[model samples]
Target: MIPIRSAGPADVPVILSLVRELAAFEREPDAVTATEAMLADALFATPPAAEALIAERDGEVAGFALFFHNFSTWTGRRGLYLEDLYVTPAARGAGVGTALLRHLAGIAVDRGCARFEWSVLDWNADAIAFYRAMGAVGMEEWTVQRVDGAALTRLAGR
Candidate 1:
């Protein structure tokens, strides 16, 4: 049985490890620039940038979901964007992933968020199916634009 609950500072190491694992799984391990210290400060410092939920099974940490509040421009209402979620291979099939998602949804509802959103890669069919089964609709018409690292530096320098 997996228990899901909010993460605290003590879980930062595990969370960062899981993030690296996920990046490696996506074949983009080199792209992960976040360090343990970065996660620690972002998750535990004053006015935190995000929050996390962890899944534990039989006293062992199994998975985690990290999220932060966002806003929809059109509706002008708050939203919850699940930045990362992962269940370790050893714990998959034990309801860890679903539990984390449902947990996040509860938070979203409690906070009156207009939406709970996350992006799964187009190749991740299993995840897409799971989300669809949970009544999540893909806004296929929308394209995601991002600026990171050098682009962010250049954009800000403009």
Candidate 2:
């Protein structure tokens, strides 16, 4: 059985490695720019920016889920926003990913979160199918918008 546990500062290196592996799996090997220090700061700070869960199978690290809390104005409540959910290729069929997600769902419920949400890349058919099978619906009418780097700086007049 896969066991899920909360990650601590000491797990930063493992988390970074998993993040890099996940980036490669998503066909963007060079996309992950986060370092172990960055992860430790964000996840273990006094007021942590996020939290993580590690999945293990028989003492082997199999996957991880990184998530944060988000506010929903309409609902007037907090929600859990999953930033990343990844299972190592070697452990894909061992139910590690599902266990991690289910663990997070329980956390959300216990914390009184209004919703549990995440984004899946459009081209990842396998991930899409997996989420759908778990009763997660795609918000087809909604579009995600972002502004970063130069655009964000310019917008802030910085």
Candidate 3:
């Protein structure tokens, strides 16, 4: 069985490393600006902004999934939003990813989540296929919108 557990303060460095790896895999190696301290605060602060699950293989850190809760007005319940899911190259196709996803789904169910959702890059065909195989359907009509950095500040008229 793939050993999966909740990440703790000690796991911040590994989590950041995995996040960098994921960024590189997504073709944005330089996009990551998060530091260990920032991650620790966001993840371990009173009322954590997010939660993470670490997947281990061969007694080593193999992958991680970071996520948080989002409210769903339509469902009148919270939904689990997966921020990132990454499996080490060596551990790919070894059921690690599947196990992590299953664990998250179980958490969503146990927490009475209205839905479990995440977004994938449009070019990531392999990941899209994998998610579909896992019974996830695409929300073709919905387009995600975001405003961040300077633009976010400008929007707030700050």
Candidate 4:
């Protein structure tokens, strides 16, 4: 059985390593610019921007899930947004990912969240199938928009 627990400041290094591993798995190894100190600050600050859950199997880290809360006007309730979920390469087929997701789902229900959601890359067929198997539907009609870096600064008239 895999045990799931909340991550703390002491887990910053391990969390960052898993984050890098996830980036590499997603074919974006250089995308993770966050450092350990950044993670510690973000996750262990007075009011954390996010929370993380770590899964351990046989006393070894197997996977992790990073998430935060959001508001759902439609439901008039808060929602849980999963930012990232990753299982070690060796633990992919061993149910680590599913376990992590299930754990988060429990948290969502416990907190009275209107929903739990996350986005998966369009090219990640395996993840798509897995999420579908777990009863998650794709929001095909919704398009995601982003503003970042210089574009964000310019838009803000900075």
Q: Quick one: best lDDT, which candidate?
A: 3
Worst 10 residues of 2 by lDDT: 93-102
lDDT of 4: 0.94
Give candidate 1 regions above 4 Å deviation.
none
Q: Give me the candidate number with maximum TM-score.
A: 3
lDDT string for model 4 (41-134, tens) is 8898989999999999888889899999999889999999999999998888988998999999999999999999999999999999999999
Pairs clashing within candidate 2: none
Model 1: lDDT equals: 0.91
Over 1-158, each residue of candidate 3 has an lDDT whose tens digit, in order, gives 99999999999999999999999999999999999999999999999999999999999999999999999999999999999999999999999999999999999999999999999999999999999999999999999999999999999999
Using all chains and alpha carbons, the TM-scores for the candidates as numbered come to: 0.95, 0.97, 0.99, 0.98
Off by over 4 Å in 2: none
TM-score of 1: 0.95
Error of 3 at 85 (Å): 0.1
- Backbone atom clashes (below 3 Å) for every candidate: 0, 0, 0, 0
Worst 10 residues of 4 by lDDT: 89-98
Give Cα-based local distance difference scores for all models.
Answer: 0.91, 0.93, 0.98, 0.94
